[model samples]
Target: MKIIVTPSQPYSDQKPGTSGLRKKVKIFQQEHYLENFVQSLFDTLVVPNDAVLVVGGDGRYHNRQAIQTIISMAAANGFTRVLIGQGGILSTPAASHVIRKYKTFGGMVLSASHNQGGIHGDFGIKYNIGNGGPAPEKITDEVFAKSKVIAEYKISDLPLVDIDTIGETQFAGAVSDQTFTVQVIDAVQDYADLMQSLFDFKAIRQLLASGFEMKFDAMHAVTGPYAKEIFVNRLGASTDSLMNCEPSEDFGGGHPDPNLTYAEELVKIMFAGENALDFGAASDGDGDRNMILGQNFFVTPSDSLAVLAANATLVPAYKNGIAGVARSMPTSGAVDRVAAKLNIPSFETPTGWKFFGNLMDAGQVTLCGEESFGTSSSHVREKDGLWAVLFWLNVIAVKQMSVEAILKAHWLEYGRNVYSRHDYEAIPTEAANSVIAHIKSQFSSLPGQVFGSYTVKLCDDFSYHDPIDGSVSNNQGIRVLFTDGSRIVFRLSGTGTEGATLRIYLEAYEPDSAKHHLDAQVALAEMIRIALQISQLVEKTGRVAPTVIT
Candidate 1:
């Protein structure tokens, strides 16, 4: 096949958000649109002639087509090797593991995580550095800047490789000293091996065989194959234990977000009185985030992180000890208590997984998470869904306790941080900006003021100075701290594709064991009322209630 240099112009709006550049499928289908960005990434990466690039997606619509284009473009760019998952499918966490395990230069993961996927739905691409984490802001900014002036992109006229086969295909004829190679790999094995090394699988299998009923919902997304292989084949769980274990491009027309709003099917089944199982779990579209449920209990992501940190030593990978821990700013303080008890450093950064990458790389943090249903350790560099699942199972098998009992005991030891996040999605950008501006304006006057039953202790816009790199990020979010240890935080969601999403996080710490049993909403009712009144959220947004509460 001959290499073709296709002329093209730059495309605006190519900048990546908190995660990646995500847009409707139509935008990506435009002539020379995807190529311009791909070329821009290639230009910014500046990989070697023999460098390896791993490419795969979440099995969404147009995933295969995009992979074919990338393979051709990689070959033309003088890359020697490319590794893609069979059928062009790789969950976000699995892709990260493959990149680290292979020591590739970097990787391209095509996934709009937790977003709907189809012809009209969202498609995305994220570049992960050789460390198996999302490329830091510096690299992403360079790619965006390059996309504006990119002129021509190189591509080969080779026919598309059959990605369904797990084998290597080599390009022929005159070229570089070494032939370009594309290898289709089994996606689940590497990730499974990593999980097995971290977990006590034999104990989990014994628990399953001794009548521990459980259910894992893949949501018909990329985790289907991973879960099917790990839970059923390796753990000896029955086939009926898995739901929607076949990857679907459109996620069966569902939202594919593992929240109460999107994963309602799992919620309903797990909440059923006598029909509930011993354990229930669900993974999002790209399989990084997770929602853990036990019988009728829904363990919030913040709680899940705290639980994992509190019991990290139970797992084999962390049996020695965790170096430290971290959490996104909006996450609850549950983990902080654990960190304090263990006498380890606990760093808090803005709301993105990339912020944790530096800490993990520097060995300052072994476990980290955000409030957005994400949790992971130093394992690979991204939030891992199945890893959290197996951690919980291992804890249960060792303690011989139910999820609720474990939570009660944990709260008894570390107190309770009741937390909730309210998302008002798709608000006009201007309106969202005005809301944030108002919060900033009130910061000076909020301190020493009383609203409802609480007196404000302080108010300010949050900022973080990365200890590893000494880079500073300011105004990450607005927060109001009360004298009673209650808090309210407001920020704009950076990952949404629609209009700006306003996120309001509320938390109240309770040390009294008797009051821990109250409903979270009820326990924080006064603080919620005061927060809404102060922000004038109803009048500003013209929406009485949040779009979604988690």
Candidate 2:
């Protein structure tokens, strides 16, 4: 293939956020905009001339076009080989799995996880390190610096190659003489095989065939294929059990987030009228986040993790029992009680799945989760949404109980961790910062402050030091602990497409069975209201309500 070098204008809005540089699709359509960022990635890495690069996306809007551009750019930057997923589609976890499986130098994953799609919605470009985790601060900082001053980006003027077929295409670069090969491979089989190795499919199959009615909603995102393979093909689930089991470039014009609000359709069908779907679960875009529900009963992510840990032995994969459990600082402390009882190490880290990578690597943790509807084990660095869902299935199958029965049983055994998160999204950046600042300033005096019925006992900005790498991340979230074990946490979401998202996480641990009947959202509503009042969020943002309450 002939090589074409394009002189690209400098584009400056390339600084990566928590995950990657996500913006409107129009920004990526600018002349040499995507090219500049791709070049900056290569330039910052200064990788070997013949190093391998993995390129794929979540099959979101512009995924194919972006992959083509990246492949050409990789060739131009002297990469010897690029492992492109078949059809330019790979879930985020699947991309990480491929990166590690092939031992590639690193990877570029195109996804705006849990964000809306379409020409007017969000698009993202994230770089993962060779370890199959999100790029660390140092590398991302370098990429941002290089993107600001990039004057030219090299790309071969090669014809658009079909990425759906499994084959290799060789191309020559303009600036370099080295040839590059694009190798397309199936995206789902490897990930499915990995899942098989981790869990007992035969037992899960028995559960499915034993007349357990279940529902798995892919949300029309990237997990459709994986869920179909596992649920319908391997586990003997009926085709009707899965919803939206097809991948779409535009996510079928729906936001592929699996939260209650975005996934109301699935929620309605699962809880439809007198008769309800037995087991209900949904995975978000990129297939790394999941929301597990049971008919009209909702299992908070915090409670979900605790229940899973409490019953880890039921699944053959965790038959040996979990080594330890951990959660993000903002997550409820319900798991901490289980960890204490089990006499296992429990850690509280900052938000973000990358933080768990070190713990998993250190072998100090086996199961870890975040309150943001994410759960995973040491099986993979990134959270596996489907894996968590299947885990709940296995538990239900082994226990021979309905979803509601299992949750109620769990509550009877471990009491309840009433948890709720109020998300004030798209707040003005300044106002969000002010809210955090005010919260931080009051920490010293908050420990003794008395609200309506509760008195603050502790307050601090959460931080963590990874045991494996010894890397420290500070100021993860602002937390206030009340004397009665009711706690509230405040943090600005780093993954938002616009402005800032102030997330208020509330948790009240009820040790008595009598209090277990309290609804989570109602139990924490007043505490969250007090938190907002103290932070002056309403006064500053001019909005009295949160955009979404998870």
Candidate 3:
């Protein structure tokens, strides 16, 4: 193949965040801005000229344009084959699946996850290593470093080929003498097949058909196809049961996040009637995070994982029960109790899915979750929002109970780990840093300090040393553990590209079944208030309330 060299443009701010380089679409449209980042990603990879690669996005705005750019650059960089999803759309989980299925060196995923889409909204580009997990810190650091000084990016002036139909096309140049193949494969079949291998589809179908009402909201993003395939076609749910079952470039002019604040439409519909929907769920833009609700009742993500672990036998994939359970440091300790009872190891890690990859690879952990509306098993490296929704359906199917009944029964069995997460989003970066620093300063002498009614028993920054890889992450979050098992954690999220997000997680475990009836947010309100005061967040940020309380 003839070689082509395109000079890299002068582009700064190509640094990758927790997941990728996410920015407003307009920012990415700047001259050579996207190309520079793509070149940097290629520069960081070590693959042969004949290596195959996967490319796709969440069907967000600019997805096709970004894919075209990546394809040209990948070709210029001597990649032999590129397997792109049909129409340049692939859910985040689907991209991981394709990478692993093809055994590609790595893949480039364009998505901002649960954020809004459109010309004015956010866009992102992330490179996942061959293991189908997000690139490790070392690789991402190298990519970022190269991006800062990238001179230009190479691309072939290939014809504007249509991606809707799968076929092959030639670029018709010295560099394009080779064929740039596009395979318009079934986007949902492989992923659905993977889900089938992990869970019993017949059980889920029975649950949906046996007088159980479920509402699955796709939020007009990438999960629509997956949900339609699994829920309506395979699982026998009614056609109208799935909401927003069409993928829109602009996500239908709404934020695609599944949290209560963003997915208010679903919440309202579910709680509108006395005979409300039994099981209600929603997934984020790229379908990696999930929000689970039962009629008018919202099952907090922390509790959701614990309930799933306690009733793992309902799902055939976990029939043997989870080998081990893990949660982010900020999540409630509900699953910890389950792990203790089952005599399985439970771990606490930092707030990222990458942290769980090592444990999963080692077969030391089968299930893990974060407080940020995410849960997954070793079935895949990334969280599967739709999979979690199906898991809940299977649970209800085997138990033959309403959502409320199942949750009530769980509370009676495991008690309640009342949990709440307060997110102060887009605060001034300096102010957020100051709040964390203030919290850290109080750590050494805070162990025995008394505030109002509770006395702290232990205080320190949360850290993790992955048992499998021995990688350490210190200062994951700031924690104040009370003698009574009440705890508060403060951390700045690394996901956002703009201003900082201060996440305050509060948990109060009630082991007594008698007190399990209390509301979770109400029980943790006082603790959150105290945490805000101690962290000096209110005074520093000039905001007395969190942007979103989950």
Could you say which candidate leads in lDDT?
Answer: 1
lDDT of each: 0.91, 0.85, 0.83
Score residue 114 of candidate 2 by CA lDDT: 90
Leading candidate by TM-score: 1
* Candidate 3 backbone clash number: 6
For candidate 3, which ten residues in a row score worst on lDDT? 168-177
Query: Over 4 Å off in model 1, which ranges?
Result: 173-176
Tens-digit lDDT track of model 3 for 1-550: 2445667566667778778889989999998899888888887786685677888889999999988778777767767777787888788888888888878888888899988899888899898878788887777789889988888677776555567777654443354355555455666888988988888898888777778788989999999989888888888889889899799989999989898899998999788768778889999888899999887888889988988888887788888777898888888898998899999999988887878878887888888898899998888778889889888888887888877788788878777888888899999999999998888888788888888878899988887887877777787888899989999988898777579989988888777877777777777768877897789888999988888988
Clashing pairs in model 1? none
Better of 2 and 3 by lDDT: 2
Cα deviation in Å at residue 528, candidate 3? 1.5
TM-score of 1: 0.98
- Enumerate residue pairs that collide in model 3: 7-152, 7-153, 8-151, 8-152, 8-153, 9-152
- For model 2, what is the error of residue 364's alpha carbon versus the real structure, in angstroms, after optimal superposition? 1.8
Task: For candidate 2, write residues 150-265 as lDDT tens digits.
Answer: 88877776678889899888766454655668899886898899888877788789988877778888888889999988888888899999999788877889989888888988
Q: How close is candidate 2 to the true structure, as a TM-score?
A: 0.95
- What is the alpha-carbon lDDT of model 3 when measured against the actual structure? 0.83
